[model samples]
Target: MQIVSTLRGLMLGLGISLAGAAAPAQAEMLDLEKDELKFGFIKLTDMAPLAIAYEKGYFEDEGLFVTLEPQANWKVLLDGVITGQLDGAHMLAGQPLAATIGFGTQAHIITPFSMDLNGNGITVSNEVWEMMKSHIPHENGKPVHPIKADALKPVIEKFRAEGKPFNMGMVFPVSTHNYELRYWLAAGGIHPGFYSEDNITGQIQAEALLSVTPPPQMPATLEAGTISGYCVGEPWNQQAVFKGIGVPVITDFEIWKNNPEKVFGITKEFADQYPNTTLAITKALIRAAKWLDENDNANRREAVEILARSQYVGADAEVIANSMTGTFEYEKGDKRAVPDFNVFYRYYATYPYLSDAVWYLTQMRRWGQITEHKSDDWYLDVAREVYRPDIYLEAARLVVEDGNAAEADFPWESDGFRAPQREFIDGITFDGRQPNAYLELFPIGLKGSQKIAQNAVVGG
Candidate 1:
């Protein structure tokens, strides 16, 4: 718990004068359908927006009284949201998509807000790090950054020859970590396993086995040697470096620049029934995000202290600041400037872009979480159903009018897609509109009606 006096004062008065102006902007906050709400989040640094909204009284200013609870894991958090036990929760970008498609749990979950971007990293234990050091290229005595998983292929091969299972961990079955880790490994010619309808271990044809381990437990699990590596969000990756157990080899930012990571999810039933409440929540979150990235992240120090509160992230302020405040520590003390490592508001981050939704669906399909092949229109339809950018713009309009955000800060006229993205570490371009085409681009995963039949890939 590291909240300081200056941070407390800053939290109390954040954009107070603008609250009056913001109130008149739109239909976001009405005579409120529901004012008392409970939201759940995992204790990761990206959950800062939720904490900031509560501490800065942003939710209260929007005529909402909110309770923020930390959940046990991704499943429990999603269950709470689906069961109406929670109004909403911080979620993996794929949870709403996966749950809605009946991949895991069947629910009509929707997100008006995409939380933060590129807040995750892939960490390798010291033993694994030592194994990879010789294979990685170096510049001026420091290992070259954006270290590809190609460097780890030999290490996995060694484990394979020795008949040892090279275990790795990810936060969830549908987490961005799972996808990002898979993407990195596959790009380097290492098979990262697959998911099948009958066999859901996702270790089919894996060179290195990946399974779920909660983010907070990652450092300890790596230290105990149960998992040789993991892909997870901050400050857990930073925790590994600080505890001297592991070294983060690559961040999601390098794996895929500015990748969409997490979202703020609520059931579609909740949104339709209480549209105004959804708008209000979105607005408070938008304001909090702006505060986070404004003025070149000038407020990040204050945010770090606030997130270190006992009930919030609960990690040391120093560890959280490692990635949250414009830099990331890889091998302990081998820090580098990674300004967008934990993007919150910038780059239209909060918008629930349909392209972002489509991208998640592609990963689900590529890995066989989606058991059948569907048309591009099906992907587009799901994107439209799950991502509500229309509602996000309504909230953004209020933020802009309230003197908090600029008009140019949002993608006001986007047709729910981004241009073909080509920043992946594999150098593969992803166009959200061409999902099947995206699947075909993969070298080592299910594609085009492919199914895992009898523990093997059957169709193409």
Candidate 2:
């Protein structure tokens, strides 16, 4: 791969004169504040950018000797970063925000890089799927795509009639899976519940109860009847299909098209102390992200192999490839083309957009994880504090200077927010600039000055 990169660099150098383009400037190696670094990630395929950066020599190219450690779970991963055990980790988009605002653990965490987009799916056990099949529409004897949470609504009601709680699993409270699962459920008129100051279980006034389960444990937990369904990142969702234990009813892509997923999170203290190291790390990750999506994902098969190794995601290559290589499996033998299922780059996936940060904050507020109503300016300020687009754009500039990426490949002129997105499953447009108004659009969840008090929503 290094040889190929060198050859490609040489060819580009030769082509510059022929094409009458000015020669690309060589990027100077950053003066190291820290050279040897350790990063952590949960065992999910969205961690691919970190793994690819390490495996493809992008980290070494930036003079970084990186150790990519697989963490036990999201909390352990976040704690590792906060305590300086790991420099950073692939994090849930809301982790840094929740931490900064003192939700669970109070620490000032920040992310300069957004890892990937739309890499999660909500899966239900075989029993639950069998029950839901009748409610779901079909075409050509297969269930229609983007199967809404309405299909699960009747099933949850049935469970209620049977005097049982309809339990579901998400990776963490602040995880994209949690918000995506809740969003999908609420869109179909099933309340996934809320989190209050006293009750952090996030099951207040709920139809389906959501709890944290580690990503790798999702399939087993579902099979054990501990959770009827789960929302998690690959290859666990694909793993369930491989084991015939569950069916993935929907991908987060269908819930919110191209929604921002994971971010590479580090403490503010670390970034402040090792500014050059932060830029260097971001540059390498940017290159890795570009490679993952380059040539229409021509390198995905290779990426699957790397992720399937024991030290990485450790799932079967075929299972990892089920979604990583531009398709996703919903039910057994129901494989379909979903080209954007796991986006590492393209669509500015790596840029830490403030709007993306604001979207997560909105979800945090909607779900009661945030106890008080915050103004729109508060949302923007929190996003600015946590999502460092300045660092990300600087790294992008350096990567472009190094001839490792095209200037066109980045949102160099972006104002750090995406244009208001409207591709949600429920058809509600999200204007990040007006978060409170967006909150008002939701039927379920906290809005305005509403707060969960004594087991009910009040003060709206």
lDDT for residue 59 in candidate 1, whole number 0-100? 83
lDDT of each: 0.90, 0.90
Off by more than 4 A, model 1:
1-29
Whole-structure CA lDDT of model 2: 0.90
Worst 10 residues of 1 by lDDT: 1-10
Residue 249 in candidate 1 has what lDDT? 96
Q: Between which residue pairs do clashes occur in model 2?
A: none
Model 2, TM vs. native: 0.94
Candidate 2: tens digits of C-alpha lDDT, residues 1-460 = 0111242345466774222221234466788798778888888899999988887778777767777788898889888888999888889999999999998899999999999999999999999999999999999999998799889989999999999999999999998999999999999999999889999999999999999999999999999999999999999999999999999999999999999999999999999999999999999899899999999999999999999988888999999999999899999999999999999989889999999999999999999999999999999999999999999999898888888888898887889988989999999999989999999999899999999999899996
Per-residue CA lDDT of model 1 for 304-401, tens digit only, reads 99988878889999999999999999998799999999999999999889999999898888888888899999999999999999999988898787
